[model samples]
Target: MSSSIDSQTAAQLQEILVGADDAVEFLSGLAGMAAAAVSEAAGDTIECAITLKLHRRPVTAAGSSARAIELDHVEQALGDGPCIMALREMSTVLVVDVSLDARWPLYMQKLLDVNIHSTLGVPLEISGGAGAALNFFATRPDAFSPDVYEKAEAFAAAASNTLQLSVRLRTVQGRADDLEAALESRTAINLACGVIMAQNRCSQEEAMAILTKVSGNRNRKLRDVAKELIEQLSGSPVRTHFDT
Candidate 1:
């Protein structure tokens, strides 16, 4: 590993990252690229972790590979760790001297257990809220240099912009899902209301009241009651009702 990357290489990397189209793909690429660049520049091996938050919580590690899943498990099991702190504080936190830092005793112990000595964490900015964190780890003490910090901060800024775009994408996707679900529910409820109107010769309000009463009596969701009504109207098997 070399202790420096030529300015040309750094410029090329920046250009590629800026020109990338997909936010998630860009962030993923930047993580690996930045880690490699820094490791080469520092003449040491490094490990990095990027955690993205969704719906105000860190998503489960279901879709990740073993190493990532293990990291997520560590954070969950430890109850307090660098990732949690980074997410909470919304700033970079460097544990250059983890052995001397006494702020998080339990977390530091877990880090030591895992043989993680030095760490640097930077928050991934999310518009409208606190976002995610990208953390880098080194086995050796005092692995980060002043130049490393400067370049790492610049890379982190680019990564943060991509992460913010991801947040927006997720929000839009969530809204789309919500709208689709609402549409389906409204369609089912309307069908059920129409069945009631025809069968009981009642007005829309009366049908809704009847469904509400049935829902309360059965301790069931309104959607369930409405679905049952629609199923009956469509000649499906009707569920038997009983007194609570």
Candidate 2:
């Protein structure tokens, strides 16, 4: 039997997806939608999830149900599963029957304990960042036949494109946040240096030298040292040369 989504559901899914503002949430929700579509076609109960590894951190992006999310968590704890492997190998892994799959005995046993017997993982390639994968779960063995796989593969392709955009968006946002942090660090360091200059009657260069020395000696980041100085001087009388 061919598993495929109806036209109406596809339209609604598109509308729902376009509203998400972040890549993580969007992909997560997309995972749920894809699972629903495939399950509907298969006419069986199925669960779905999305996992993405970005910046070397792996997160469960979304799940078709709470159980789906929980399943992914189990795999993460064990550091083994078809989904995690799929991302690492950059390929698809299908455990047609989880209960008997020898590849990940522990991981398979965990799934079986939860009454989940089938799983499929498909990796997604996002340019300029760590990759991701879509994971699905089912109550029965061999839940994802070739027809179901084909439908999911197509959905995964579309999801990959969206995930790429989301990754890029986050990358840009991350850079902006870093820049802002650097600016704040500079401000903090300068404020601390100015305070020291007044209190010790020293030149700006001397104040900076003292700060750098303290930072190295204490094995603390320069910003951390600067922050400590600010805290200590928070309520003290203003000691800048211009203070009267």
Candidate 3:
């Protein structure tokens, strides 16, 4: 991916960033920006889409137009497109005329069916995040010139950087949530073991063993079993010393 955008696009991108750039839904704006950028650089651009691979699945996170999003779904379902090849090749792939493009025959046919004759896919740099690409579609054959393609590449790079930051933000937030959940699970299990220890007058190891058996017998997760034990004993009058 190119590292920097031209001054004009940089200014426009900055405007987009300043306008309601939410972490999770930011891709929609970025995809729109990509299509608008290419359109501004060269006319005849019909649609644009941004694809982000999550858990090894391609999702059309955002699009400049509905048709762009539809084409993305078609590519995902069939597992073929210039966009997929761009990501796989880690480079730009262009289908000058869908009817004449023989590399991805099925994908080309679908494009023709949609009245999208030309397509350009630019690989993006997600930076330790999901694989991504920016795709543009045109109704006319060879609608995008080499210069326009280069300009769109710069926009793709910008989208990549912004997307990477958003993805990393989500990752950090997810890790924090996971840590909190793990801590809660640990506390629950420890409390359950302590309760078992008091009731059975057994060692901590023996209490854990008993808990494990209950978990297995009930076909439940250890944490679920632990939580149930604590809940069950909470309102009991003859409760053990698990209040600590």
**Backbone N/Cα/C clashes per model:** 0, 0, 0
State which candidate, 2 or 3, has the greater TM-score. 3
Ranking by lDDT: 2, 3, 1
Off by over 4 Å in 1: 1-34, 51-89, 97-117, 235-244
My TM-score estimates for the predictions, one after another, are 0.65, 0.67, 0.77
lDDT of 1 by residue, 149-221 (tens): 6666666666566556656766897897787667666777777888888989999999899888999999998
Q: Which stretches of candidate 3 lie over 4 Å from their true place?
A: 1-24, 54-59, 99-102, 235-244
Instruction: In candidate 1, list every pair of residues with a backbone clash.
Output: none
lDDT of 2 by residue, 1-244 (tens): 2234444445555565568776556766787787887897567977888887868867787788899999888888788789998999988899998767899888888898999989999888879867888888989999898988876776777666766666676788899778777777887889999988999999999999999999999999998898789878795422323223
Global lDDT of model 2:
0.80
Comparing 1 and 2 on TM-score, the stronger one: 2
